[model samples]
Target: MTRRSIGIVLNGVTGRMGYRQHLVRSLLAIREAGGLPTRDGTLWPEPVLVGRSEAKLAEIAARHGLTEWSTDLGAALARPDVSIYFDSQVTSGREKAIRQAIEAGKHIYTEKPLAETAVAATELAELAAAAGLKTGVVQDKLFLPGLRKLKRLIDGGFFGRILSVRGEFGYWVFEGDWQPAQRPSWNYRAADGGGIVMDMLPHWNYLLEELFGGVRSVQCTMATHIDTRVDEQGESYAATADDAAYAVFELAGGAVAQINSSWCVRVYRDELVEFQVDGTEGSAVAGLRHCRVQHRSMTPKPVWNPDLPNSVPFRTQWAEVPDNDEFDNGFKAQWEAFLRHVAEDGPYHWDFASGARGVRLAELALQSAREGRRLEVPRLEVPR
Candidate 1:
C-alpha cells in the first residue's frame, strides 16, 4: 500500500478560525478520526504552523503537538515538504500569501474573500490556472446538514418552481468592551478589509448562487451601526467598517432573495442562521439544525382580523425534517470532504474560481451599496 504524506503550510495559525477550524478540525480531527482513506488505503497529511509571532506560534504549536513552527512565512513557502499552502489569514493579508504560494508551485486552500476586490480575485485565479495546481476555498456553509436538506428539497421539486429565498444571519457579537472581542478588531475597520458586507457576503454568494441561482444584480444598504468600539487594548477606536448590511438579489432563475447580516442584532429566531424558501407549490424554512416544510396541499387558511393581538395560521400545516446520522456538524463535514479531496480523486468543487466568484459578488454588493444603484455581476470566461 502506498501512503502519501501531504505537507500543509498553515498560515495564520494563531487566529481563531485558523486554530479552531483549519488546524483543530481539519488537521487534528482528521488524525483522531483515522488517516484520510484512499483507494489504496489512506494518507497522512501533516500541518506546519505559520505565523508572524513567535510567542503565539510557539503556544499554538505546543497545544497542537506540532513539531514544525515558524514565524517566517516565506521559508514555509519555499520548503519542499509543503505541498499545500492553507491560508486562514485576515482578508487583508490573503492576497499576498496566496500569490506567493501559487508562485511556489503548491496547491492552495483558503478561507473566504480570495481577494478584497473582484479584479484581484480574477488575477489570482488566472495565475493558479497557469500553474496547473489544485486550489480550493472554504465554502463550509453549503455543506451544512440543514442546507444539504434544503438543496435536496429544491432538487426534488418540493418547492415547485422556486420563487424566492430569505436569509437572516448573525448574533450580537460582543464589542470587546467588558469582555474580550471574539473577533479581531481589524474586522470592524474598513481600511483593513473589514465590514459585514465583505466578511459575510462571500458565504451568501456561494450558497445562494449555488443553491438558489446565480445572482444577476444586487441592491444593498449598509451602515456602521457601532461608530466606536473598544479594542483588545481597552482603547476606543473609530469603527469605520459596516456592522450591518441588507441586500436584495435578483437571481438568474428569476428568483429574488433578500439577506440581512449584522454583528449587532441578537438572534430572534430558532437559529443563528436561517433561510426561508417560498415556491409555487410549497414553502420551506431551515435553520442550522432543523428544516420545516409546508406544501401546497397543506397550505394554511387565514381570515384577517386586526382586533386580535397576534394570530397566525401557519403552524399545523408544516412538517419537521427528520434527523439523520449523516447530517451533523456542518464545519466538520466540510473538513472530511476536503480531506477526501486531498487524499483521493473525490469531487472537489470548492475551487479557487468559486472562491473568486464569492469575492466578486461581495465586491459588487459593496459597490451597489456605495453608489446607491444596482450593479450587474460580470460574466467570467474561464480559459479553455
Candidate 2:
C-alpha cells in the first residue's frame, strides 16, 4: 500500500484550545494511530507547529517528537509541502493569517467565529472559493455522543413535531484574585474580540440549524456582570465584553430557541453545557455526554400547592438514554473527517460558507442586544 504524507501547517498551537484539543487530542492522536487509511494508501499527517513564540513552538515540537516548528507564519505558509493550513488562533488574529493562507493555495481548516466580524468571515470564504480550495470550519459539537443520540431520537419520531429548544451553557470563571482565571484574560476584553456572544453564538447558530431549523430573527440582552478582573499578569483590567448573553431566537419552522451563555453563573445542572428540547409527544435533555428523556405517557401531573412543600421529584421522572454504540471524542471525530476530506476529496458539509452563516448569527445577536430590538439574520451568499 502506498503511504502518503500530508503536511499541515498548524498555527496558534501556543494557546489552550489550540494546544490541547486541536494539536494534542486530534492531530497527535491521529498521528499516533498510524494516520488515516484510504483505499490506495495511508494519509499520514505531518504537522509543523506554527506560533509567534519560538521557545513555545520548539518546546511543544520537542515534547511531541516533531521535527518541524516555525515562528515565521509567512515562511510556513510559503512551504510547498504544507497543503493544509489550520488556524486556532485568537479571534482577532485569524483573518489576516487565513487570507494569507488562502493566497498561498492551501486548503483551510480552523476553529469557529472565523473572524471578529461577519464581513471579514465572508470575505475569507469568498477568497477560498475563488481559489478553489477545500475549506472547513470546526463544528465539533454536532459530533458529540449526546447530540448524536438526540439526532437519532428526532429521526425516530420520538419528539413527534418538535416545538422548542433551550440551552444553558457556561461555568463561573475565577476572578483571578484568589485563583487564576480558567479562561484567558483576552476572553473578557472587547478590544481583543472577546465576548460570550461571539464565543458561543456560533456554536448555537450551527447547532440550532442542524437540529431544528435556520434562525430567522433574534432578540438578545447582554451584560458584563464582572466589570473588573485580574489578568494573567495579576493586574486588574476593565472587562468591556459581555460576560453573559440571554438570547431568544425564532427558527424558520416556527420553533423557538432560548439560549443563555454566561461565564459568571455557577453550575447547577448535569454538565457544563446542556440543552433541553421539548416537543408535543416527549421532551429530552442532553448534556455533553448524556441524554435523558420523558415521554408523554410517562410524564407526571403534579398539583401546584402554594401552602405545602412540593413532594414531586420532577428530576427523577426522566429516564436516561442508553448508550447503544461506542463514541469517539467530538474534536477527534471532526479531525478524522477533515483528514479524509483532505486525503480523498470527501464531501464536508461544515465549510467556510457554513461558518460565515454562524458569524452572521453572532453579528445579528450582538446588534439585537445593542439596539434593544429583534434583528433578522440574513443568509450569507458565498461562491460554491
lDDT of each: 0.85, 0.92
Lowest summed lDDT across 10 adjacent residues in model 1 is found at 323-332
Give all TM-scores, in the order shown. 0.96, 0.98
Enumerate residue pairs that collide in model 2: none
Q: For residues 112-181, could you state the per-residue lDDT of candidate 2 as single tens digits? A: 8999889899999998999999999999999999999998899898998889999999999999989999
Candidate 1 ranges with C-alpha deviation above 4 Å = 310-313
In candidate 1, what are the lDDT values of residues 257-335, reduced to their tens digit? 9999999998789899999999999998998877899989988677777888556656666898776657645666666
Runs in model 2 deviating more than 4 A are none
